[model samples]
Target: MKNQEIAKILYEIADLLEIEGVEFKPRAYRKAAQNIESLSVDIEELYKKGQLEKIPGVGKSIAEKIKEYLETGKVRKLEELREKIPVDIESLSAVEGLGPKMIKVLYEKLGVKNLDDLERVAKQRRIRRLKGFGEKLEKKILEGIEIARQRQHRFLLGFVLPEANAIMEELKPYVEKISLAGSIRRRKETIGDVDILAVSSQPEKVMDIFTSMKRVEKVLAKGITKSSVRLHGGIQVDLRIVGKESFGSALQYFTGSKEHNIEVRKIAIKLGYKLNEYGLFKGFERIAGRDEKEVYKALGMQWIPPELRENRGEVEAALNKSLPKIVEYDEVKGDLQMHTKWSDGANTIEEMVIEAKKLGHKFIAITDHVGSLKIAGGMDEEKVMEQAKEIEKLRERFDDIYIFHGIEANIMKDGSLDVSNSLLKQVDVVLASVHSAFRMEEKDDSPRNKSDRK
Candidate 1:
């Protein structure tokens, strides 16, 4: 889908505009980018149908920008912003403590344009000399640069999943067996490359189809057993065709987090077996080469799920047969915390309810900000009563899902809730949160507090 591609450019535009100190438009661009990014359907399809404005936060101006991008593959305004500011916003933003304002300062004062430039400036002790920037922040920027370097080219799992699935669907018919392997199989939050393991006697044919796919930007290497290609979006896809006997073992080895496989190999050694990509071996005889279950069974352990194969005590748990069942994504039936347009959220209460219903949620809470947190447009007691009336009407309209009229009361400096008891009793739930003064010293729980409670 062009959704991610378009969303990325729009997000860049937002950052670029923000760097230029443009008001309101940056936020508008960002919100539009967010709405487009979350869309399940193609942005191109919406553009074709001229329904881009139907997307929340997308007005005619931003919708026109999206259309311009789709039709021309570039936005003129974004290009102009890029030429003016010329800062690598994404890389700099990846720094935990850095923001657009700081980036603007660094660019204006230190000529910091990218992570590398930021690091150089931080190391040279130039940032600390500037107003509002300290030695500590400079040190933090250096550390952040290291982190950004590590995360440089990794794609979000959500972005790469569709492409990987599409490839599998295309190549499934050409192989005896096939499964996603590597970090993709383990479902890492960020992925470096796509790895697919398949068993096929006709490896040549499989490799041909895999490398020749429409998404392939360049064929890095192509062989009978293995092939690697760079996708148009810069993600690498590696296809490997192994023997049917070694498919499971290959799958297990390839789906490793390195540390997980290392521990599993140690278990194999302890049990007088050798484990590798080919199979689990016993004195050179293949003991478990057919399936993952048998391979783990041979190791005297339960088979580990791909997600849990991160070497985080999973091996021990599997060996002890004490692996806890992890909750699947679809197992969630309700979302307890949410905000509507009544507060800072982009969507309305009814819109949230409709989306939640589509996602199979049995219940949802509309926990809008309330009380003295005016920064978030927090509702007062009177406004809460008004929202309650609206929710009651909604609850009647949507009978399938339970709607909870909730309030996110701010926790004041003294650690007491900003909401009143009378108002609290009126809502289904009270989500008391620290909305301000995050770095304040914690108040001691002295006997005085207990005495006040008494």
Candidate 2:
């Protein structure tokens, strides 16, 4: 938790530095932030051991900032930056059409410090009067703000999953059984909140532990069987404690894509068993409730993985015993695509390989971002060749794993590859992806003809 907090401060410092047009330091700060966030162990533990600089990207300068934050609950540099700028860079950056440069301009020219100020300026037609921001840009800004407003609070699972796992780990010793429920368990792309289910004899004690955790920013509610707290990052997590007999059913009940649960309940009704969070019952006689598989078995279907429970064909497939054999976590052997410090990834190529090896991956690829995605720290042809040398050295040291050297080249707005065909021939693999000019019309999404290019 302290790791994430310190990393957030570093990231904000980087953003503030960029807005101030500082040279070189913003990228350095961002790199340090990435390394901090990627650390497998607690940064505070490292601090206690006086080994903060042991982290990949933490140099003497960045290490000092981390120390200040850990010792004082805040960094003085970031506080100074915030006071000087007095603008909410992080929140404003979320608004489309509002990049760092644009944000700086808005702050200086119109005194726009936040999303509301930007909206107010755009609506009043004052933004169009700015030298470069014409009526077209102003119109787009309004639309982007509306879109951002509707979806501002939703967080990507990649960012929230670690926190969820950490919280569960903390409560493991106190609860009889515990699990992450809701869309988080379903592996949904965007999560509005986190739901945790547990079987605990001491419900009140568990709730107290949950609401009192250091990562918890505020305890929204406290109850004997249920409680909710807003984490430091603004994700509200709800804890539900049920009877041991209801543990499995409660998990199934809360780990839903709503529509999926409704379909399962319908199947239970047809099978002459009533189903709910408590258990599957026949005329009030509890039958299957202690295990999730038993509930599915009573409904005459396979137990679907939470990720596949989206009310798709999974229902019918489960019933017919044709449910696809999803790859077990251990069954996976290779990681085909990943980034390193060459791009926006937090770790170096060797560090990534070492961690992947720990995860039992037999093979992996170093597909760092390249060509035209500078915001992601993309590399050029020269840098790509330089990284290949490092990867080759790593291959010699680690003989057990196959390391595929590759590049995640960006797809241009015209749907053309960013890396030259000549340069592409040098790599073992090439992964193409879209990074810019998104939200284009369907017809423009495909590659254009060579003759159409200017």
Q: Backbone clashes per model, in order?
A: 0, 0
Error of 1 at 383 (Å): 3.8
**Could you tell me the lDDT of residue 346 within candidate 2?**
73
For every candidate, C-alpha RMSD to the true structure in Å: 3.8, 3.1
> What tens-digit string does per-residue lDDT give for candidate 1 at 1-454?
6787778888999888887788988888887887888787888898889899999888888888888977787889988988999988888899978999999999999898998888788888999999999998888888888888788789999999998999999998988899999999999999999999999878899999999997787999999888999987679999998888898899999999899999999999999999999999989899997798889999999999999999999999998999999888678898999998898776789999999998889999999999787867899999999999999999999999999989999887666788889998999988989877765544644335645653
**TM-score of every candidate relative to the true structure:** 0.85, 0.87
lDDT agreement with native, every candidate: 0.89, 0.89
RMSD of 1: 3.8
The stretch of ten residues in a row with the least summed lDDT in candidate 2 is 444-453
Task: For candidate 1, report its TM-score.
Answer: 0.85
- Candidate 2 lDDT tens digits, 191-302: 9999999998888889889999988889999999899999876889999999989888888999987999999999988888888999999998989888888889888899
Which stretches of candidate 2 lie above 4 Å from their native place? Answer: 20-24, 54-61, 105-111, 342-346, 370-397, 413-422, 436-449
